[model samples]
Target: MEISKNIRESKKNILLLANKKNKGHIPSAFSIINFVYLFYENKLNINNDFILSKGHGCLALYSVLEHFNYITTEVFFSFGDFDSILGGHPHLRKNNEIKASTGSLGHGLPIAVGKALAAKINQSSKKIFCLIGDGEANEGTTWESAILADNLKLNNLICIVDNNQSQNRSIPTPNLQKKFSSFGWDVITIDGHNSNEILSVFNLNTINPLCVIMNTKKGKGIADMESNFQEWHHKGITDNLLKLYIKEIHEEAIS
Candidate 1:
């Protein structure tokens, strides 16, 4: 419940900021917050490695970082603007806390796979986590990386797909879990909006690489936005709408 509350609150504020900044990918940002929060709070090997392959959802990562004091409030407010450390995507050079610069889609997974392989060879306990989008899974390289992860049995490596149906103007129509299963991955599917369900996916430990397919709405938690794919995906955040939405989110967060 705390994780859900954090996801809801962080997502609301991130959307408010996105609206003020006229940003895109606001819903994707909301959809991944809980996983991001959980990775930071409980799952990830923070001192080691992690990747946000779905870099459009960087707002979720940034919100968690800002919440935890990895960056300043001024930097967060200035996101997407010039000279701000927080860009629309994660950049490791800008902040040491960011494990990788991940706007390139489909690239982070292979890289994480390499790291996991290296760690396994070196007999290191460190691990790698990569969060990607279902839409981004359309990339051929992502599947190639999945095959490698499975063949090598990189159990220390974990990847999550934000299966939010819609991607770049079209919703994903294919069976995501089936695709991963065919790749020989240990696949699990769950409701992304439910914190408990998300947490359960995190509990999976396997001899092969794991791929979690999270079924999420593009714009979850916002009354006018959840699955409304048309209005809020990449629009300018109006001040009026921002205020109303924030108020609504806060009320829902506490309830």
Candidate 2:
């Protein structure tokens, strides 16, 4: 499949910003890049809400929004600078595109459930889309939110887990599909990097809330960081490594 120019450009920009700031969850951010890209590009409906529950992955969200002019290059590069609106984790007021302030694991899904319930009570057509990390799923609050969402039959709520499987701790629930299905959710597991399969899930019509398990690599594009290397979760990018990454990404874009 042809990679979109916007995706290619945004990814390059994201890496450059990471190098400049010298701090970011680059692995976590890269893992979810495709999810954010496809959602805004194809699955998002106007007035619908989105939350990057895994706040460390905000770079991916920021890059996608910046690609569409929702944010500026100045603000994007200002990430992690003292008092910058953009921080390591997402801040709601940072930009109009960001729906919730999240960095704490397990907070996003609950917030999304609340939004979905509120929309349902108001009889609005809006849907709430939230992206969580497989690591974040280890939190108890995540399961609580999942149960509540299903109990209330919040069909408008869509929770997607970026199952990169690179979390620092042992996975609390190994069988994600069975866990969600046991909670009365309509679960779909797909290759997180595949745009086609990711886009196809949006067409699914189900009575229960949707839970998509997106299997993805931790540091997807860069060969050195492609797996769950704990260090890559948040590491400084040296000048040489940055050049190498840029070269690899550009070559991959063309090939």
Candidate 3:
């Protein structure tokens, strides 16, 4: 897929903002950009809610939100400042667009489940979508939430696992599709970088709760970052390094 110049440039801003504030889990944030890109592009915000269960990926959401005008550019660059509305994690008190305050792993999906349940009970047409990390699957609460969501038949809920394999060094979910299926949820696996695949998911049938396992590469845009993802996971880059990284990403965009 051809990368849009706006998204390409947003990559630079993400790096620059992190470089400025010295905060952000770049690789974790990069892995899920396309998912959030499609989510906002499709304007699911009209009657749906989204939760970044893996709150460390806030940079990705920030990038998308700014591009969509959900947030201003001024606030975009203010990330991690003591007075900024946006922070390292999503905060409800800071921003209305942020559906839930999330940072501690394993909490977002449970919160999403509650929202979906409320929507269902209220007979509201709103759908709840939550994005989580593969490493978060290690948390028992994540699985417990999955059990509860499926049991409740929250067909209005969708949970996406950013299956970037960053947790292989600790715990690995080799067959996330099978695991979700076993939990009685409809599951689909796809390349996370593919925009078409990401957008197509919203139309798929949902039996219980739908679980999308997006197979993504950590630090997806730049070659070196993807190659040495662990080092770039939560790294702060020097100006020279940032320039090189931006050049590499620009090269990929134009290639």
Best by lDDT: 3
Score candidate 1 by TM-score against the native. 0.91
lDDT of 2 by residue, 16-90 (tens): 987898888888987888879878887384578889999999889988887767777887888888978888898
The most accurate candidate by TM-score is 3
Better of 1 and 3 by lDDT: 3
Error of 2 at 137 (Å): 0.9
Determine which window of 10 residues in candidate 1 has minimal summed lDDT: 246-255
Look at candidate 3 and give me any clashing residue pairs: none
Per-model TM against the reference: 0.91, 0.94, 0.95
lDDT of 3 by residue, 141-185 (tens): 888998999889999999999999998788887788898999999
Instruction: State each model's CA lDDT, in order.
Output: 0.78, 0.84, 0.87
**Model 2 lDDT vs. the true structure?**
0.84
Question: Against the true structure, what is every candidate's RMSD?
Answer: 2.2, 1.9, 1.7
- Candidate 1 lDDT at 81 equals 82
